[model samples]
Each structure stands twice: as C-alpha cells, then as structure tokens.
Target: MKRGWWLALVTTLSSLVVSNGAAADQSITALAPFEVFADGFRDLRGIAIDASGNVFVADREAGTVTRIAPNRTRAVVASGLQHPVGLAFDFAGRLLIAEEKANRVVRVEANGGRTPIILNVTRPRWHAVHENGTVFVSTQRLTRDTDRDGDDDRDSDDESDGAEIILALTPSGQLRLFADGFKGLQGLALNHTGRCDLQDPDSERRERRHARCGRTDEPVQEARGARTRQAGGSLPHG
Candidate 1:
C-alpha cells in the first residue's frame, strides 16, 4: 500500500481549506507544496500529536517512538518496541501503541517505561480510544496454509480461512469481542456520534464501515460506505 509515501504525505501537509456550506455542498482544498515537518525516519508506521503540539512517530524498523518538539528538537520517547504500527492517546492522556510483532498494546509512560495494557493479541494493527476510556483494537487472523503444504504459511490470501475482529477493552481491564466479519481490517476511529469506524481495505462491498456499539459493548449494527484511505493515527476523544 506504499505506507511510507502515505505517511510522508500526511506529515508534510500544512493546511486544508474546506468550504463553509452544507454537507453536500462543501469541498476541500489543499495548499500544495507542502513543507517537510521532520525527517530521518526509517519507516513511519504511526503518528500522533500530543496536547503540547509535539509530534510522536513510530518507526517500526527502528523500534522507536521519536518525539519532535515544536522547537524542532527530537528525542526518542520509547524504544525497543516490536513493530509498533498504531498510536493513540487514552482518556487519561497516556500514550498507547499497538505493537504488532509483540502481539500486545502498551502504554508509554512519562519516564519512557512500557506497561502492557492489552496482551495476547494477534496482529494488532490499529486502535481507537473512546472518551469513556474504552479502547477498540483491530486484529487480523490469516490463513495457515494454501498450497496444501504441511507447514503453516502466513502469506496465504485465502480469505475463507481468515478472520478479522475488533476487541474492546474497558477501563476496568475487561476484554470483550466488539465486532467481527471484516477483510483486511487496518485502522479504527471514533466518530462524533460515538460510533467506531473501521477501515477494511479488502472488504468485498466497501472500504469503510461504521459499527455502532451498544451499552453492553456489543456491536449493534454496521453501515458500509464508499472507499476511503486508511491511516495509522487516531484522534483522541474528548
């Protein structure tokens, strides 16, 4: 998916102008010739901006989460991570990361300490945090074999044997299966109405789907829409 190019484009765009009108009449205009915000990143998988305007980026290859301050100073806030691909902030302002290779999600402390929050996950790709301290993480389970070989193969594209689901983690540390039945679940975000939107690039019908969760943390219904680009960052709910 050319993730590197997508990350670069996201980090460089300075501004976006949207026409003030009705929902169907509004249009977006981008100011071209973007300026590079920061460089020297090996592979940027995720990005997040803190309340202080400091930009934090996860370099999966380097196993580091570097922070670029407003003054252009750079510092590694967290290191030695295992394939960190998604970044978000919890309701308490704690930095959350999805470590794909580690098969867990962790909270990055102020002193650069790592505390595992959600463990025993499989291919934790991306996640979103709700205002009430509910975390929604997307996971993918691929097929084991495709060529009739006895060995397990991870690169198999047999969707019939694969599955994708989203898990919800409450503030009390209780885990529950929130939603399922997806193809290529990549990213997640909470909309204004408190519904969680999932980006499934390989879905047969659509690219994005919004799943509304009930008070019991179960998915009530899902609505599909047109194709949309998926990114590795999430907005913190108020």
Candidate 2:
C-alpha cells in the first residue's frame, strides 16, 4: 500500500505578530497553536511563497499545486501534474515546479498557464533558484531492474545503485551538470554569497560549494564535452 502525507499550517500568536518600541521589551506569552488551513492536501511535497505572500504547495499524490492566500483562502493553481515535488519562484516570479514522474520542470505563468522549461530530468526531487535566474535541480539516477521481471524493484534489500545528481539550468535554457554522486539528496538552497548547499540525508552529509552561472571556482562536472574538474577536497560528513 502507498503511504500518504499531510500538510497543515500551524502558527502561534507570538510568531504571527511582533511588537516595536516599548512593547518589544515585554515578554509576550505565546498563544495556543492554531491551524491556518486544516485539510485538503494529499502528500504535500514542496512549498513556495510568492512576492504577494501567496503560499504555493505541491501535492504529489493529488498531482496538483495549490495556493493559499494570506487571508486563508485556497485556490488550485495547477492540476493533473505528474508527481510534482519541489517548488520555487524564478527570477521573473514565475512558479517553477519539478514534475518528477513527468521528468520535466514546468513554469507557471502569470496568466495561469503552464510551460515546460527543463525537460528530460531523471527523477527530479528538489530544486533551488539562484538570484541570477539559474535553476539548480537535484535528480536521482534511474532505478534499475536487475531481475528480468521487467518491473523496477525498490525494496530496501534490493541493492540498487542509484545516485543523486544536481543540474543547473541557465537563464538562456542551457542545461549544465553541476554535481554528481549523491545519495538521497533532499534539500537544496543558495546562500547570500551564491554558494550552493545540498543535503544528503541517506549519507548524513551536507555539501556546499560556490556555484555561479557560466563559471565555477571549484571543480564541477559540466554537461556535454566541457572540461570536468575533480572536487577540491572531501566535505566532512555531518
């Protein structure tokens, strides 16, 4: 049987509002937890907030993306998606969704339209958008069916050798292979200094490197026939 996940927005009064001036010094007792939105999501995977403060979430099981307004109103942004996992806002403020099962990343336009930006991604799980419009996507290697049964087996004891990788999509639509050889890569983010960090929960390691568009100070595996450089050193496992 397939497992399911749920998403809920819970907040405390102290986190909701802050005081200024004289009231700031006073200790405010946190109010009881309250749910902003309680239901209507199936297996929520990724979430992104736009400039207007609308919260967008991807429902993997439901194959839909929903937007929740600040006033707690809900709206379906896109539907019938194939295993949409990660969500981010691009430089132009368009919603970027990593459609895992579809092997593509789609952009949500302001006019409520969907456009495919990055295609042929293998098991795209999470992505982060850089300030300069570069999109970094983490993907898993395809599952192998060692047996001749013609079905992909993902049993814990199956001994599959799938590795996770990170790819960068330039603003001009060029795809570049950023990094490789990760296991169970989950979260990806970019710091203020333009350094890219990714988490591999399976390996219990956090990897970070400065990754810039069209350039790299450290070693990186580039796409196509571009020169490949080995990583400078080993990162300490967390």
Best-fitting candidate, scored by lDDT: 2
> Which one wins on TM-score?
2
Give candidate 1 misplaced runs (Cα > 4 Å): 1-31, 141-161, 204-238
Residue pair clashes in candidate 1? none
For model 2, residues 39-148, the per-residue Cα lDDT tens digits are 44657677766767677878887888888888878888888787888888876787888877766677776666677776655667788887777888886543342112
Off by more than 4 A, model 2: 1-38, 142-161, 217-238
Cα lDDT of model 1 by residue, 66-95, tens digit: 888989899888887777888888767788
State each model's CA lDDT, in order.
0.62, 0.64
State candidate 1's TM-score. Answer: 0.68
